[model samples]
Target: MTVHDVTAPDQERDREALMPEAVIDDEMIASMQARAGVNLRIDHSVNNEEATRIAVTKFAGGIGDINPLWTDADRGRASDYGAPVAPPSFVMACFSGIQFGWPGLGSFHCATQARFHQPVYWGDTIAATCTYEGFTGPKPSSFAGRTVTDHFLNTYTNQRGEVVAEINWQVMNFERASARGRSKRDDKKQDLTLPHPWTPEEIERVEMRVLSEKPRGDNPRYWEDVEVGDGLDLLTKGPIGLTDEVAFIAGGGTPIPRLKAHAASLVDYAAHPAWSFRDPVLGSSEPIYAVHYNQAAANAMGVAFQYDVGFQRQCWQVQLLTHWMGDSGWIIDCDAQYRGFVYLSDVVELGGEVLEKVVLDSGEHAVKVKTHARNQRGADVMPGHATIALPTREGASPVTLRARS
Candidate 1:
């Protein structure tokens, strides 16, 4: 059948509105689950250096990390590792944007529990697979009687079939009724007592440094020159390291199973699953280093070495824009595809430019931009788009009204 005969215009438009190009099915879900649980081959050769670099950059962006180790080869080489390394969270930046089937997956409220096994290097060709772990929860909701839960476990291995990282993620599919019942509240009440805490002198120093280092290229993007349909160059991020990874996991209250085992032996441990360190969100009493900093357990898990969490990449992307654009711009929406694994000692670079511009009905200048992050090897680990509001070039004045008494 011809394209016109097979898909009607209305149907095509509806499909585009609902989801991405990939179509997820039951069989695909089952297959992904099975493969994730056991060993499944999903390999990608390291041919795309640019893509790798982008992945690392995006991961670094998520973490708000400006460490020279991930950006400068000379500084990285001076480190103990003797070379640049990718951040532990680089895996998330490098891999998540690629299409993996499981319909309604994005609709769920997602959370991740990731364990790093090894350090991925520049030339390593990695393979990965994800499995379904099952589902949980059906808590009462105002709209639908029950909500659905979906769980997935993913593992990535290198060329030698050694597992580098394992991730357990949960997604909560809330019913529409429950969502509609929630109270509408304005959540942005800022504390004004300590606004602009920085001294004028400190602010001047920071502004000078930032202005001097503002990313300038042959293709300069001045505020006045920007217009609709402009494409920005891609951004680069990481060769991540253990220090940053440890900081992130510890800061975010991430739990590690192996560390828990150590803690249980030292103290009187609780028997509850919620109390177990294996539980991603609970069981934090003291600082533990076995999972993130130890090298022995990492090798046992078939990883080249200790690495970082995958979700941190998301954080890096958020950081990139928040820091650069200041609080005035908001992250209206973002979506990423995971492509490859990121290991310690790899450098990443990330940057992006505007794509389109339009004036909203409210006269706000809305700009849509495409952004991406890459690693040292030039692989595009994460690529996505964003929208922002900026001051208009026209310099429109605010409206004023007078009242006659």
Candidate 2:
């Protein structure tokens, strides 16, 4: 049979425009994994009090945690230890200013599995580094027919060079164009999963507790009263102990085994580096305080037991923005600079206000907000900005398009 070609010009033009810079392969994954580790030094001297306070408060506020041990110094001192204590999650709540070096890795979708080795204390200097643990090739799936997994591990230490916390994180990079045909497979998987719905009565009970336990503040924020330029005050956190850290690590989901192993090591200093004290309070010197996990050591320092990881604070900052904005809103961009160490019994406060509002040419209403996490001493730990979308005022018209349909 004889056939004639009948391709249209516009269709041909569109096909020609669909060129990709590179195809997914093992070479790409290898290159990315090879450069995953980054070394970072912790500076504990600059505004130590403020830094520590801010770090702790940010985490507490972000998680809606109101543990008195972290916020009340006198009450905490009267408890098990003779000083305020940080929450176990405080370590993760504090910010660690480590920048990942990777080319073309636009945005990070991170998942973490953390383990606490020793409690982090106040006035402790920490050093940290991260390594790319591994990577997986594209596996056959309904979505894009494949996907890649990037894994990274971070280890932290006090001034005495004792490893206190270890974290394992994973990220999945999806091929955007290839995701179009996976809906059928996703729907099928969803149908096979069991639904665990909460009862209305149970939900009501939980909500009541949450409302009653909400943190105290001078001004109350009602959903209707919040504006684009309002600021969120600093939230407080810490002094946590090994027990608290273990609780959070056990809860945050991850299959990695190292996290659990590290958590078990916190009880004994022989398994890990010894904690020590440093002189001059704030200097470019080594640390000298030991007993990061011992109750006795914490009492000597006038603080509670060891606390959580500082890096976790970054997650809290992100969480705070998302919680305030609700599910419909998203965090487009965020960055944090770790200023100082957060210890047990530190009070951190996170606050921010609306910076500006702009109407994009595309008719999307965007709100620019600036936020900060600080300690009780008024030191800024992590200062960041977020861009989010909010519903336009009622009856606002959409932007006009100039292109022909």
Per-residue CA lDDT of model 2 for 1-405, tens digit only, reads: 111337576753332211111336666766766654533332321112221544555445545555444566675455333444444444443332232323222112234445544544545555555566566666754444455666666676667676766766555544433442243334344422111234667556545644443333112122334566676543434332355444433333111112222335343223322222222223211111222333333323322233334345565665555445532333444445445434444445666888877665655565677878775456776676666554444522111111011
Candidate 1: tens digits of C-alpha lDDT, residues 47-78: 12222544454445436555444555565455
Candidate 2 lDDT score relative to the true structure = 0.44
Where model 2 places Cα greater than 4 Å from the true spot, the runs are 1-23, 36-51, 95-111, 180-206, 211-405
Output the lDDT of residue 37, model 1. 44
TM-scores of the candidates are 0.39, 0.39
- After superposition, candidate 1 runs with Cα above 4 Å error: 1-62, 65-225, 228-238, 253-302, 360-363, 393-405
Model 2 clash tally? 55
Model 1 poorest ten-residue lDDT run: 396-405
